[model samples]
Target: MAEERSKVAAIGTFASAADHAECRRLHRRYGTTYYFATQRFPAAIRRRVHALYGFVRVPDEWVDNPAHTNKDAQSRALSDYRAQLLRGLEGVRPEEPALRAFCDVVHEVRMPLEEPLLFLDAMQMDLTVDRYETYRDLRGYMRGSASAVGLMMCAALEAGDDPEMLAAAQALGEAMQLTNFLRDVAEDAARGRIYLPQEDLRSFGVTEDEIFSGVISDRFCNLMKFEIARARALYALADIGIPMLPPCAQKAVQLARVLYSRI
Candidate 1:
């Protein structure tokens, strides 16, 4: 819990961003310390991370936004959002306010420009495709969406070239994503998004119909238990990467791991 506490401490700094104000607000809405942690980074690193956070906030907004009617609109919005982000990174003023501040972080960190954009690719997967056929499929989604962000953050700390470190960071990111999948199954299905592997559900004698029933059965509980167990495995793998980092950042990562997997 020490690490998670540090993340909580860091999240407190989010309120200071006047320019990327809405992004900060959105971060708060989804559970910041437990979900996104640029605010939870060390003070020296916080602002750049805040920009990363704001950049990330855009793709998330496009997916979770109520205004998105179907796959086409979502894809177009995400495509445009990503392009605008690139322009902002290149020092051009963006039409979107979120990208404006997000670009500042991009310049400040001088991070590998490919990471946050890869994250956009991940969310685009969510908007366009909802059914996962197997663990392999799910893992692919996690890699793009969450693992890419983790690897990029490692780069932010200048660990980009270190394959082992990035691997661990990716594990942590997947763990965080898996936790969200468990907690949000009900909410996700209501919105026509189902991330649980279809094969896993079938193997365990569960069905999509049961999921829609909203009734918690012994089978459903068992299914959740299996999913949580899988997420925990990823958390354990992520733990292998935490100790290699300097203090505050390590603590922040650990904190997010614990809180996100708390259920």
Candidate 2:
């Protein structure tokens, strides 16, 4: 039956990458701005790009998995990811389906060499740095982990290297990250990670316990305002850049950022 064949294909396609599902599952589970924007990509490109996100997500998982493991094993897992990524650059077929799909898109889309590479590089940085003391430190990590993604997505659109466009994209990327940092405060703290800048904490006279409690104090509210304002500014900046892309692409990116801003 045609229906049966369709069902079979869905299961077959999805099952191939079940081990690393967060990336695609995010597409399925949460149709937020990011995923919805992705849906607007060319169908073939969308699938390939989602696969690329999956590969990136798995490395993210190991660091935040909460399964609690020895450092050596975790190190090996990241090293494996680095190896897989490097292999993709050589035009090799990645054994992992996500990598396979990602490779196809990167090659066809001409995504920047550093977008995905820098993301992985940022993940490596995660294993070592848990606290950021300054805005510069945070920006450095965002450059690799978040800005790189924004740049890559633009690359997927074959946009020329317009500095203004790149700046807006990076701002949008950090806005998303800033939102995430607010929501995941408790969980990150559980894993011994604190994304709130040390200076901000000091300025507010808030300690780790105050963050873990989740009770809103005036200081806490003030601190949250600072982060939210940053996200808002980035969203504003992205508006300018979005118009530069194809109209549909611009809409998709707009939708994606708006959806995540809901967080």
Instruction: Kindly list the per-residue Cα lDDT of model 1 for residues 52-117, writing each as its tens digit.
Output: 566776678678766776878888888898777665554456777667766655555455555666
lDDT of 2 by residue, 1-263 (tens): 23211111111122245533544774565434567677777765566557666766677778777894566788787787766655655654456666655555666665555567678778888888899997778889999888887877776666668899989888888888888888898888888888889888888777878877766789888888887887898889887898887664776688788888888
Each prediction's TM-score against the native? 0.85, 0.85
Model 2: colliding residue pairs: 33-256
lDDT of each: 0.71, 0.72
Given candidate 1, what's the lDDT at residue 76? 89
Worst-scoring 10-residue span by lDDT in model 1: 4-13
